[model samples]
Target: MIEVIDEFYSAALAQETIRGMIENARGGYRNGGLPVYGYQNVRSTDGNGNQKTRYEINEAEARIVRLIFELYAKGNGLKNILMHLNDHGHRARSGGLWNKATIASIVRNEAYIGWTIFNKKDTKIYGIQFKPRTEWVIIKNTHPPIVAEQLFNRVQALIEERHPTRTAARTTASTYLLSGLMTCDRCGSSYGVTGYGRGKKYAYYNCLTYSKKGKQVCPGHSIRADELDAMVIAKVRERLFSEFNIRQLLNDLNVATRTVKDGRCEQVKDLKRRLADKEARLLRQYEAIESGKIDLSLIGDRLRALKAEQNALREELANFERETMLAPPVITRAIIERYRQEMEQVFIGENVQEQRAFLKNFIEKVVVGESETRIVYYAGGIRIPSGIFPATSEHPRP
Candidate 1:
């Protein structure tokens, strides 16, 4: 009796399971046997000579590409283009506002040149995608190019040219003369200027790194507007009076620079020799790989290190050429005369910016400590240290 009951229950369960399977199959057929918002059927050939489904450019995307190229050709940088589009009430295809990331994407994309690039990004551990340049597969002239190859290359060059070297924020109005010139004596970083109040405001110059990083990183030293002007004027006068000392400094600099010329030439030759040796080694390694005596994988690591060394040597050689071989004679009398004329104008100048500019041209780095401020002036390649002034002293306002 128990066996019979168990058989009956099993039969019922099997029938129900079959019914559910049939319903699922029918539903799947009705739904086209694919996910809603499924990936579009893309006709593309893979590296392994197999057809693969991938996203292709649409008409709207092609128009955007053309627009980007046109904007780039007009000397509008990526940021400016993005800002202009946003300001003009232009929306992206996704109906979203333009952003830096989107602008960068449009600028960097090479697909506008009729090439199809794949595998720009891949999934790494559990749903995390990483984009690697090395893994990109490029198919040349896959579609009609919206932008010409030459035009695209020029746009790319322009983009790279506009990339900022430093992160110093630039103001629309040029105010300070020594805005970008002043450097911190302690860390050798540029000084940033800030102002307080409205018209007839008090402006101060402080080390940028220290201001941003706080006093724990660097002791914040400041030179007030009036104090700096007086100090610079006094130093100029002092240097003018000591004519003999000024001439001696210039003569010494000239002699020292000339003496080092032969050494600089020898250094350049040595660097060239080292670079040649690396190139020969790289060539030999390539030959070994071709001959099946060495593994090609090891060559990459060796070449990277060798290339870095060669680059360093080349930089040193360049520096030697610039400093020793190309250094002009530093005439102290001429410098003094120039400084005196500038200083006189600076003292009476109505425009603060002009005054600051004159001072900046002569002063290299002004080190303001707790007690004294030391100003270093660079004439040609030689550095002349001017008189130290008390940091607490007051003077006429700009």
Candidate 2:
């Protein structure tokens, strides 16, 4: 019986998804996913007050996309293009640092050439499987193309030529604790390490743009790697793990966590009931017309109007359910104490790779200036003056 019900539910879901896909294609709207990097989902109402959603270009992100294409077309390697973007302090649509995979995805996507492609993959009980090119449903001229067709074509060809075998490269794990998390305030690019010495490393975090593109692009912002890391470690110890700060952090986290409200829960239930009632009433009215108890012509417009209302109510119910279902993280005194005891050791004792992971969990980004580096934590951020840490530290060496 359970298996039968599971099969039925899957069938129903597949049908609904197909309906949604067709509607989205006809309406030229984003088909229920994260808005692509250079686009945003715009929700509005149609002439008869029917809800509609469409993908519109985000000019800021679009400009970055164009720059990527331009640079690639001008014969820059993938890594060089990535460096160029990071050097300029440009972030990916997701607001993280630029990477080769992201650059490759943008270069390969046909959407930039004004196409909405779907059904390129199939999801079944096992998992997702890629569909053949023949099965893909592509709608052309869905919106304004960010890149010209010629330019897009050229980039695609270049990508194919550059990686003919399409083999994935094994990336060496980063040893710098804050490699990608740190940003250069002067030129907006991510900071990278350079200048090693005789068995004694002289690593420093310098603007990637200045390191590669030259001082013409950025004034060569830099900080000694050891000094910066020590400062960050000290600040983390001072701000996050301090007794007063831990209590405050816990309080803030507790507040930020979401809770479902009774009002919203009630609203969801009410909307569902109303939708069912409205559908039943409309069905009976149609039946009456079919049975000749009511004139079809007289109630045709009313039936259409009622159906539209049903769709609107369904949308409203979905929105309510989504918002009410989010639950916040719970922090306790015990957890705080455990974290306080372990954080210092984790930051100081862990190898560079492990330290990087730890930093990502708490630090959002580090903006480095000439005199001060603003350490942006995931919770918020704190600024500390540069050149303040000792040349060395009691912290365990990696």
User: Each model's TM-score?
Assistant: 0.29, 0.40
What is the per-residue lDDT of model 2 for residues 1-398, given as tens digits with 9 covering 90 to 100? 99999999999998899777766666676666787778888897766787877878899999998999999988876656776787688877667667666777788788887898877767753654657889888788877799999999888787776663775432222676778888888778888674332343456567766555444456655566777887887787677678898889788767655333657778899999999999999989988988899998898899999999999999999999988887544789888788777877777885887778877887899998877889998777899887573222111111
Question: Which lDDT tens digits does candidate 1 get at residues 262-379?
Answer: 6777877887888789778878877898999998786788878887887887788688767765765555667756765676665457776776666666666566544555666775
lDDT of 1: 0.58
Clash counts for the predictions, in order: 0, 2
Lowest summed lDDT across 10 adjacent residues in model 2 is found at: 389-398
Best by lDDT: 2
* Candidate 2 lDDT for residue 19: 78
